[model samples]
Target: MANVTVVDHPLVQHKLSIMRNRETSTGGFRRLLREISLLLGYEVTRDLELTTMRIETPIEPMDAPTLEGKKLVFASVLRAGNGLLEGLLDLVPAARVAHVGLYRDHDTLQAVEYFFKAPTDLHDRLVIVVDPMLATANSAIMAIDKLKERGATNLRFLCLLAAPEGIKRFTEAHPDVPVFTAAIDRQLNELGYIIPGLGDAGDRMYGTK
Candidate 1:
């Protein structure tokens, strides 16, 4: 089984609480999301490979460690994922970015992919797939499937909030990939939205609704 990390760090929880409040302004929401994404990115990158190198400090030469050869490729699951991507890019400015667009059908609640673009050497890079919500898990699973088809084997999924059902479904479908989330909500409603979740992350982030 894949490890599902619920990031209960006080900072994450505190930001999530603020995000859940409906009265939070659009500017505040966007700012908080970026901050939370940076925090989550830190945890998700904990195991990244590193190599030691000799470097000269202000006073003298010293051995320092830096990331290994493999560069990161960030795959954002469209609209909302872009918000998360901004903060992550601030941390890893050199990482390449790809976009995978998916929308849920209202009646079927299935993920329908409309656009996908990724690096040619996807298999050689560490890929981090980002989105704000993991509700039905349909979109995330499909996105991962497509990435694997494009030769991406090293991958991780990161999100701000996830539903329990979505987590179970995602892990069952892709046991090899680990997942990182700030919080896990109770369940998805009949409409496929997570219960008590901040409604429509995309709309919330963009102030479209």
Candidate 2:
């Protein structure tokens, strides 16, 4: 895909395989999600702009490279997105956080927003939207729309798995926003679930039915 980046790192693929196994316990699933997310986060933030700063090392003073501009924002799309958010935070502890609460209405497969809270200056920072799955893409689309309305100009979407249908819909909806994922699955099932995906991320992570 032109705008999509699939992180095919060995560690990522290994963790994702474990997560896809139905026999994996909830605690195991949760732990793997957090672990793989760190790897995925590394790829997503690879091109972050850097600036040079003068700092004294143990040996001598020199210009050190540091992230430029304002701290980036991680916009998590509701409950499931929190899985990826936790690990990304571990990587960038100083990054700003945003929460966009959206749940899929199973009957219509539409997203419904229940909550939203973000920094007031979204226009000035890079916003990376994180979610475990992008099956129907309804929730991801709506979450980004809300963030744009709030003045988020530069944005990206990150996920553990994505269906071809969902990727097409997401790219068409927001062409400028790049997508980062661990894997692009075969397709979406009739019920809007990613085929071969790790089941419902929220249910698996929380040990709920």
The candidate that achieves the highest TM-score relative to the unseen native structure: 2
Number of colliding residue pairs in model 1: 0
lDDT of candidate 2 over 68-172, digit per residue (tens): 999999999989999999999999999999999999998999999999999999999999999999999999999999999999999999999999999999999
Error of 1 at 198 (Å): 0.8
TM-score of model 1 (CA atoms): 0.97
Candidate 1: pairs in clash: none
TM-score for candidate 2, please give it. 0.99
Top candidate on lDDT is 2
Instruction: Candidate 2: list runs displaced more than 4 Å.
Output: none
Residue-pair clash count for candidate 2: 0
Q: Look at candidate 1 and tell me the lDDT of residue 137.
A: 95
Per-candidate alpha-carbon RMSD to the true structure: 1.0, 0.6
